[model samples]
Target chain A: SQQGEEDPQALSIQEGENATMNCSYKTSINNLQWYRQNSGRGLVHLILIRSNEREKHSGRLRVTLDTSKKSSSLLITASRAADTASYFCATVDRAGYSTLTFGKGTMLLVSP
Target chain B: EPEVTQTPSHQVTQMGQEVILRCVPISNHLYFYWYRQILGQKVEFLVSFYNNEISEKSEIFDDQFSVERPDGSNFTLKIRSTKLEDSAMYFCASSEALRETQYFGPGTRLLVL
Candidate 1:
């Protein structure tokens, strides 16, 4: 079973607009990481935020995690056409190992 | 910029036949993992391997599934008997250490007839 669920299954935005996707998990997590999948290709790790941290940033991407709320959000600032892809949130449980449980994912479409 | 690599971008097999999905992880990585995604579904974890043994596995990984690091660079997942329900995109991932970031391969699309 999947531990996390993402909201706004699909999102469409114009270039330079920001895109936000939210995810919620059911159990306690050690960390949450976001990944991007381009069509039929592999997943690319974007950002990872530990349970102790609330927010993290990488390039134009920003992620905020709220353990109290059991949710997390990924924000892409100044989106571009190339940024169109499926975004997934995976949670690593507090089970001592790093095995991840992923969400259904949010499909983002950036129009030029 | 080393990355994980999977073989035979696509594979087709009969329902009762055995199939082995192969992967070559980053040279120095210690942990390996396998995940699958049915069309229009979330990615699901199958198993995680470290120190030449399985560290963890999901309920989906039943008796039909097995993982092996047969050689220095090759990690393989063998399905003793494939089933129609097994058709999905199988991904291979590896991490340099436990509880760290993982790198994934392009994935192998398997079709069971």
Candidate 2:
């Protein structure tokens, strides 16, 4: 079963604009994390929101998790051209397993 | 900040051959993991190791796959016999503890012929 599935597979925005990506999961999760990947590069950890947490912030990244809805959203504010990359949402299930089930990801293109 | 490092940034192997992918996780981390991403696909978790043994593994990690923390610093994933379907980007990651933010290493792109 696919756990995290992100919407708007591709997103394009101008520099300084905001980009919002949403992810929905099938089962209960211990935490939901966001990661960024440049083409052919490894995933860079962005932010993590635990099931008990509603929102989290780091630099320009804001992540919100709604366990009741089994959904999450990542908002990158004041987006920069350098932010052009694929953003993925991963979930750690409540089963105590450490594996991360990732989404297909949203490819964000920030234009200058 | 210390980060996970993978050796042999890229490798090409023939079918039925064996290949070993190596990684050096963050020094202070106690948990290590292996994940892979096929071209244009989602990153999938292969296995997770802690305390020198595999704590969890996905269905994708079958008999063809194995993992080892050969030493205090190095963790490795060995594919006994390579398959064309095995070609993908393999990433190593580590975290201080379970459920913590994991730091990922630059992936090793494996191409199986």
Score every model by TM-score: 0.97, 0.98
Q: What does candidate 2's lDDT look like per residue over A3-97, in tens digits?
A: 89998899999999999999999998999999999987989999989999999999999999999999999999999999999999999999868
Tens digit of lDDT per residue, candidate 2, span B1-113?
79899999999999999999999999999999999999999898999999988999999999999999888899999999999999999999999999989999999999999
Cα lDDT for residue B34, model 1?
99
* Candidate 2 interface RMSD (Å): 0.6
Q: All candidates: CA RMSD in angstroms? A: 1.1, 0.8
| Model 1 per-residue lDDT tens digits across residues B1-113 | 89899998999999999999999999999999999999888899999999999999999999999999998999999999999999999999999987778889999999999
Worst-scoring 10-residue span by lDDT in model 1 chain A: A1-10
Taking the tens digit of each residue's C-alpha lDDT, what string does model 1 give over A1-112? 4578998899999999999999999888989989999996789999889999999999999999999999999999999999999999999988758898899899999999
